[model samples]
Target: MKIRIMIVDDQALMRDGLSSILQLKEELEVVATASNGQDAFEKAREFTPDIILMDIRMPGSSGVEGTRLIHRANLPVKVLMLTTFKDTELILEALEEGASGYLLKDMATDTIVQAIKTVYSGGVVLPEDLTAQLFLDKRKTPHSDLEPVGQPVDRSLLTDREWGVLSELGKGLNNREIAEALYITEGTVKNHVSNIISKLEVRDRTQAAIYAVRHGISTTYDF
Candidate 1:
């Protein structure tokens, strides 16, 4: 099945360029385009595309706010932020708001297409430089003692082996990589990941990683 896509950018040229490029890909279809965050939200509710290419800066509402709204709506759409800004804070904000990935505005068309597919497949995508910047920002920020607001985390819920598996996961290791690194079977790594997700009350690996970071449970490992 072709992956349905939506473009949300204020610039007409950008929207047109992205649409033209995506139209050439047999595996993707550009279902709709919107000029602003509000329009994108409405169209997202109506069209419900598999992925959305969102621009970070817009007149009415910023892409970060829009991403938050889409996430709250609980739609199946994954949002890939496309923007010219390289601000680390902005990128982290978007990710926290539930963006699946981020891409630079000047990136090649093929890269953007690949990012859409990667995010749709439940993988997080970010430029290596941006990813480094994100980690650097995290490290530079002083650790806070405040706890995150949610169900209290149960440390006893995860076994020591499971915690080790999640430590690898928080470092952005895939199941195969985790297995190879830990000298374990891929099936075993998968089982550990599943248990970790269930214990953490997160929907995906990305969320699980975020949870680990927020709680300081997996901060020693680098991504």
Candidate 2:
């Protein structure tokens, strides 16, 4: 089945151009297009596409605000932000608002398409450069005391093995690499990953990794 997609951008050229390119893919179908965030949400509600390709900067409304609105509405669509800006604050806001991935507009068209596919298949995509920027100066960004809306998380909620796996995630290790590093089977790693996500109240591995990084927890803190 072709993945339904909605392209949202302030510029008509960007929206039409990207839609033209994306619709060429056999795996994708351009179901809708909108000029601004507000229109994007309206189109989303009307069309219910599987994914929305959002741009950060727009004249009437911003992509971050759109992401917040979409998440609050609990639409069954993933958001893949495509923008030229590398503003860390905007990137963080989008992530917090449940964006499946963030990509710079200058990326190769092939890469953007692949990111859309990845996000469609329940995977998180983060540009390595942007990821490093998120991790590099963590000390400088004022820490958010806000936790995911739930009962407070504690170290006791996880087993030592789960903590070890989460710390490896903080280092950006994939399942295979984490398994090899910890001398555990990949299936075991997958199981641990599932448990960690549930225990941490995170949507996915990306959020779990962010939680570990923010808490400064590591394998050394585990068994």
Choose the strongest candidate by lDDT: 2
TM-scores for every predicted model: 0.73, 0.75
Model 2 agreement with the true structure over 1-223: per-residue lDDT tens digits: 9999999998899999999999899999999998877888888999999999999878888888888888889998889888655466777778888887688998888998888877776556666445544555433557844432222347687998898988787665778878998999999999999999998788888788666655555323444
Model 2 regions lying over 4 Å from their true place: 137-191, 201-205, 212-223
Tens-digit lDDT track for model 1 on 1-223?
Answer: 9999999999999899889989999999999999887788889999989999999988898788789889888978889888765465666688778887688889888888877877776556655445544555555667823344222456587887887787666554667777988899989988998998998787777666655544445544322
- Cα misplacement distance, residue 129 of candidate 2 (Å): 3.5
Q: Per-residue lDDT for 216 in model 2?
A: 54
Model 1, residue 61: C-alpha shift (Å): 1.1
Q: Which candidate has the top score in TM-score?
A: 2
User: Residue 218 of model 2: what lDDT?
Assistant: 39
lDDT of all predictions, in order shown?
Answer: 0.76, 0.78
Q: What is the lDDT of residue 113 in candidate 2?
A: 87
